[model samples]
Target: MFKFLGYLFLMGYILIPASMAQNHVFVEAESFDNKGGWVIDQQSFAVMQSSYLMAHGMGEPVSDASTTVQFPKAGTYQMWVRTKDWAPYPKGPGQFQMSIDGKPLPTVYGASGNDEWKWYKGERITVKQLQVKLAIQDLTGFNGRCDAILFTESTDFTPPNTLDELTAFRKKQLKLSDQPMEAGHFDLVVVGGGIAGTTAAISGSRLGLKVALIQNRPVLGGNNSSEVRVHLMGDIDKNHYPKLGRIVRELDNGDPGNGNPNAKEYGDARKIAIVKAEKNISLFLNTHVYRLEKQQDIITAVIGRDIATNQEIRFTGSFFSDCTGDGTLGYLAGADFRMGRESQAETGESLASTKADDFTLGTSNLWASTPRDSVSTFPRLPWALQFSDEYHIDEPQSDWQWETGFGNYNTITQAEQIRDHNLRAIYGNWSYLKNNKAEKYAKHKLAWVAYIGGKRESRRILGDHILNQMDVQEGKFYKDGTVTATWTIDLHFPDKKNSQYFEGQEFFAGTKHIRVAPYTIPYRCLYSRNIQNLFMAGRNISTTHVAFGSTRVMRTCGMMGEVVGMAAYVAKKHNTTPRGVYQDYLSDLLVLVKDEPTPQP
Candidate 1:
């Protein structure tokens, strides 16, 4: 048959036969056209569902990555890899080692095994050359990771070890593209470029819509960006959205200290020059999304991926918004959320916990330190986490409670073991303040830390109003109010002396706050009751969990992303859905949340 369809289209295979398949090959370690210094970590796409390539090298040993692979029907394969032994001790401090057309193998592979992401294997090569290379050496510059490289030549095939069957066996053995790559059509997509998705993509591109603004971190301030430095707390222009936070004061990085190394204050090129000066916005940035496509209850698109060209784009929208803060494209479009703490008789809230629980709150990784004029050495971590002395904390910085996972963990399936237990509580409290507070941090050092985990709670989604804590302590005035929230219920916890030294795993943190009286919020707690067009501003809106401690700050989630980008520009000028802008365009979402006259001219 035309020479077996030209050797199955030159071995990239379609339905087998490049001399009959050979079971698996896969590859993709950032398609390594020489990824030497490694480091592509697309922050655990909802927990190791993709984007990897690590070898971080923080403790030093880097530069090796390599890549090339080709072989179609070679002889003895077996490889394996996928990685993550990230400190499973017995000898695991993120080790590495592998190579192939460049020799070196003796199975070093990551290091024992404990942080829960398997695969490993190795050795058994013999390809008889059809293009080879491979590489990836790193023996502890600390991070390690890898995520992809299968090989196999049937020793019972193997592969698929869950994460939805290894993301559908890497989308059908890396043939990928189940139709994605579009990334355009908009009208208002806005999936987290944070400050409540870049003020809902600059208020749905100044009410004209056609937005997009994805942002899987390249910065646009989710956790006030400067890579999670957080600082843009409450109050902004006042309730019922007074010109809804004037696009969050045109992207404020105004620096109020949250990881300041002599304060450059996260301007992030003035929020990417105000979302590239919004000509009907488009943004994207590192992309991410994961997948979505719904129909019965809306959602229609959302694919993403591009963590440095892993391609797959697909956006499409006519009003979407999940401002990701873990609502992750509204939990991949099945929506209907709510996680942790609810029952004081089911959200009469008053500091909940009379039943419903999973505890919520507790993420921060924040750090900073400076002083250097001389002496600075630090490096005796022994795979961290061992603090003593009444739970030591001699801080040089980090105010956001250097937090860790939380009571029952599972912050989106234990976000990389809660950002590696806040990097082993900031390198075991800066190596116990450089071996017992060297004359009060002698020369300080450790400049900045946030390995991005500023998160504060997850999944709220369920909307059409969930707002609780007695509707912000009885202020309640709904008419679809739309963001004012101010911050006071605060929350957090796990710091009873670091929860008596890591019991249930604590990493500092403590807060209760309570204060009150600022209110407003509503727009039915920002869209989606059954995913009928998602929407939702930061801290995953729809509140509860003590009204997401006063609508989880970031300028009250940037005025609920300027009232869901003015109700997704009145749901694309009335084709409708975000609860049809409060049931048939409630006075055009109250004149786009009274950006001018909710009263007082």
Candidate 2:
């Protein structure tokens, strides 16, 4: 007896019987009522099919995530948990247990010896009540994860293992619709909530445009948010465009050095407050844009799925901006993009490699520890990457240098692997220091470890003019030069000492900074070359690998967003495309840039 209720759009999940089919019940880990220390990880949702809950305690066990579920009937039911042993070589460090009504389950999860996500069957237990409390208890606190839990009565029932099969199964079970509900049309729809996207939305709103700022994560400021903890970099309002960086300054909550243990220093609330204050801006957090509708060369709308509930929302707009660091939106719309470094011959930059390769700047999962008054104990991790005195990084806390996924890994496809690799390195090194050098770090305890990896370089969306290294070094200025990038052309490679030990999967990074004068990026580099109605900012902006080193910083990226927003306003005012703004309304844009007003909250 199923009674249908109207679809709840905001909640993202359909109102269905908690017990589907009277014999089976599906519960998403991310939808837990009290998540405790567990974090929602959606980085691999595109591949894995759903966002899961992760216990990232560094070493110590974190608090349990608890929730209540309603069973169809109080009878014998078999339980299944979808999870993976992140490191299954010897044994997984990410170990955890599930409990019902405070009673522990017989089987331990996350150490099933399977490297991929699969369903782990649990003992059949008789349910004593229809509504019962459930909890996920962490064992090792070394990044254990749980995707979803299923309770079924059928003995032969097995959850789908394949991605396609699992996707269909989830839709069928959850009763999700094929069509997406419309999220109001806007003048400009920004697809990222980083410093660049946040600034772009604010800029467009201030310039009299209805803007929709959609961020995949719950918080704004991608890396600078409390989740990642990277400080804002690059000089703001330096030389060319004096009034460009005012919006960025509003969101800057002092430089909380990379991977700071104090979360408040990163200023998540301040950014949220400022964005919410904008009357013309509609902020959609925790919504990831996976697909888009492109008519001919113009993008008309984007389809985003809720990270937690899987509800898809369609955002229609006149113009769109690809601020996703990985160029996700642009790639979905079939825009031209480059992933790795360009060859010396291709870019004519001396810093470019001899030949084109997959070598790109790595991602960082920074961690920090504090010295406790009392001596602390850490478990020896045999399953983690072993580290010796000669090979170990003897540091109190990890910074931007603690990075992975350079030449050997794909930053987008293998992102979870990259993050897991960093976790292994972090835990392994910490274990070594705690065991071997106990006298020095006897009282040290891990305070914070980032679950969300801070990425440097990924897909660079191709635009009208690709910014190059020589352009920055030789002070090549454009008439349409809007945002001035002042950071040095700093490029990172695997550390020689670390490479000797870890080889291809080197975790430590070494960078050489080539000094450059303040160079203004051309307006042509802000929008896609072929994709009409498309604008891009952040690390994905059109740039050679060498030039990206200079423009990839947050402040510089934010300035690019400011320019994009201004251009969007002009384009909307004249009913022209992004390119048409530069070609036809160049003077109009320059006038706005020269006389930019102070942004109000």
Candidate 3:
């Protein structure tokens, strides 16, 4: 990960303790099928490291997951294990325990699930040179993947004095810290780690801003994750926006290689790998930002908490960007923003509410099932439509899915209903498979459901100009446009029956009979109305509900991030606020964004 020539003499520079003989070993283990030595389906995998960690379930969940790994030579040895959260509910972080000589360590749970491939460290402990054992546990109370077991001692180690060399050496290290022991004070702070947040962090850091990407969870790619489990429906083509995420393209394990054929899990592993390699990005994976300190519209410092340690920490940034889907930081910083639908009289949106509805479409917990693939019946919700094989597919090879939206209720209450609706949708499909005798898939069960909630609507930061559907329909182009949306004015309502209750028009499903072409979205929607020197991106951008529905798509959102990042860079260069770039230098901003060869993004 170091720059060119940064690796020279790096290996010998920082000498770390290693085994007396300086020996190394490799081991390979699969899910709990210890049939002979570590093997998958009885086939051996070439060992790359000295650990044959097992998932312990043949990739299935074991009723009791505690397993013991005998330590070879226990002199303050460090052990590494990886596992997936295979639970009915999505996996939260879990814990692992160490038992030496049948006695548990002082701590009940040793390490949580946050330590996946990115999680590494060295141990500082004194152990009698005797064989010992470690018992690992999943405190997260979920069942999933666990493997890549590694064990090593002080004698077998190396250190690098140079930052580049140190980063290179950290690839396999595993350890943990509780409080704000890690460094703080970043040059730029990205307040969300979703797609926009992730890109902003990486891009900003690559631009030489010591950036701290504050994400809610361990992984990046907000909606497109095992947690949210939503397929990214954005433009992957460069014709739309300059290929800002080619790195992401390289990382994606496309449809050809996904574990679940039914689940379209395409990921930009390249981008992820790059982000992980960035030294400037101090990724606080399992951390959340709490509050902020602002002086006259400028964020002086921000406060946050490491979820595990419950420790309060403060960080300061000369420049900050709000990528939080909810725009949490912008709202707190007294940013002027609008949420829900603005009245038609306000933004001139066709579907704008006469009276704004505070209740947005809300987030949904998504579920995906293959055509003909069904499982045992789940109890159907009262509102779920009954299946009579009414919906049909003529093509035999086409694999399709149904995404049913749980209508808005109380945000919290409707969330449960939405989840239940997803479950019901799964069961209803399953019922059709078994009882209805669908010949294609009578064997497929509920394949996967999103662990994190799939959000459709939330608080939108009120920007200087709340882009509306009318403007989009009229093709209100801005030379300084930051986002371009071609998708139609697609909207969804609760049910046909509840349509009248809504202040705005209902969302039509499937039919974009009047699908709109790509229109340039304005730059005003990227900053707050109330605060100065603040920027906003992603689904939370200031737009009337009707306009937001179309612009909220990830592709457009990604473009929004890229444009915003370029604008930020311009602002940084000019030493002005985001609006400053949008205004006086807008023509220049567009030229900068389009002309600058995208960083090795």
Write down the TM-score of every candidate.
0.38, 0.95, 0.62
Question: What tens digits encode model 1's per-residue C-alpha lDDT throughout 1-601?
Answer: 3245224333432221111134677776755666687777677776766777777555566799776676775688888887877666455677878888788888887777566777877777889877777788887677777777778777766677777888776767655567855756787788878788888778778766778788876677877777677788888855655666877887875756776654348787788887887777778677788877877888778888766445566877777888888888877778788888778876565578889878788788787878878988777776778776666887788888777766557777777778877887687778888887789886887776666677888778878788888778888787777677767888877878677767787877788687888878778778878877778888887777877877888888877887787787777777878887788888877876675322111
Best candidate, TM-score-wise?
A: 2
**TM value for model 2:** 0.95
Name model 3 segments beyond 4 Å from true.
1-182, 236-264, 307-313, 368-407, 410-417, 424-441, 495-513, 597-601
Residue lDDT tens for model 2, 1-601: 0011113543444333233654788888887777889989999876776788999887778899988888878898899999999998677978999998999987898887788989999889788888878899999878999988889999999988899998887777666677877777999999999999999999999988999999999899999999999999999858587888988899999888999999999999999999999988888888889888989999999988778767778889999999999999889889999989899999999889899998899999999999899999888888778899777888898889999988788888888999999988998899899999998899999898899989999999998899998898998988999999899998899999999998887999999999888999999999998899999989999999999999999999998888888999999999999999989999998887888844434
What is the full ranking by TM-score, best candidate first?
A: 2, 3, 1
lDDT of 3 at 158: 39
Model 3 lDDT-worst window of ten: 41-50
Cα lDDT of candidate 2 equals 0.88
**lDDT measured at residue 349 in model 1 versus the true structure, 0 to 100:** 56
Please give the distance, in angstroms, between residue 560's alpha carbon in candidate 2 and its true position after superposition.
0.6
Error of 1 at 275 (Å): 32
